[model samples]
Target: MSLRTRFTEELKAAMRAGDSARVSTLRMITAKLKDTDIAARKAPTDPGVSEEQIVAMLRAMAKSRAESVALYRQGNREELAAKEEAEIAVIESFLPQQLDEAAMAAAIDAAVAETGAASIKDMGKVMAALKAKHAAVLDMAKAGPMVKARLGG
Candidate 1:
């Protein structure tokens, strides 16, 4: 099934299970997706959001929460950090398996080879290639620097 369909069903299940935290997180995701969809439809004629786009949105949200959690922890707000972590767990349920170090390395290598990226000037080509194939599973924020490093920038 599609990601949105799965999310709707999971939301219903969470409601039935009285999982307030999970339900809240799911609702937040759906709301963001709906907002994004509406924004896209303001100009386009399509449904305005693809599954991969939604996955990217979720990954961004999760990553933001992760950063906030770290900051909160550093500030000694352990309770708030734990809550953010819980939200992250709920958000991650819909994401595909993330690439690890080895997989990320291989992906960077392949993208560089495919684009024949010889210098920092070709970084965009390498990044675009990797994004097209692995945007949903790989953390580009982390992999971007790695790609630049490989390109000797």
Candidate 2:
């Protein structure tokens, strides 16, 4: 199912099941998607955001909430942290299962090999290859440093 369709179906199910937290999180995601689509419409010839872009947005949302969870915990706000964690769970439901360390290392190795990347200067090519193949499953923020180190940066 398309992410948009899944979101609608999940939202309805949440509403039916009286899952208030899930309902709220799903609504927030749709709202964000709407806003993103509107922003993308600025270019007359541009289509709105693609599914990949939507996944990227969801990842960003989850990452932001994770940061909030950390900050909330540091501030001794357990309730707030828990709320953020719940939101992260909801957001991640639509994302592919993340690669574990070993899988990620293998993916990076494959990208490096595919790109014939030998030096730090080829970091961009390797990263681009990884992104093209694993944008949803890989966390580029973590991958950046790993790729850099692998390329002798």
Best by lDDT: 2
Best by TM-score: 2
Instruction: Report lDDT (CA) for all predictions.
Output: 0.92, 0.94
Total backbone clashes of candidate 2, pairs 3 or more residues apart or in separate chains? 0
Candidate 2 lDDT, tens digit per residue, 81-133?
99999999999999988898899999999999999999999999999999999
How far is each candidate from the true structure, as Cα RMSD in Å? 1.9, 1.8
Clashes per candidate, residues 3 or more apart or on different chains: 0, 0
Q: Any runs in candidate 2 off by more than 4 Å, and if so which? A: 42-47
1-153: candidate 1 lDDT, tens digit per residue:
998998899999999999999999999999999998997785666766998889889988999999999999899999999999999998888899989999999999999999999999999999999989988888888998999899999
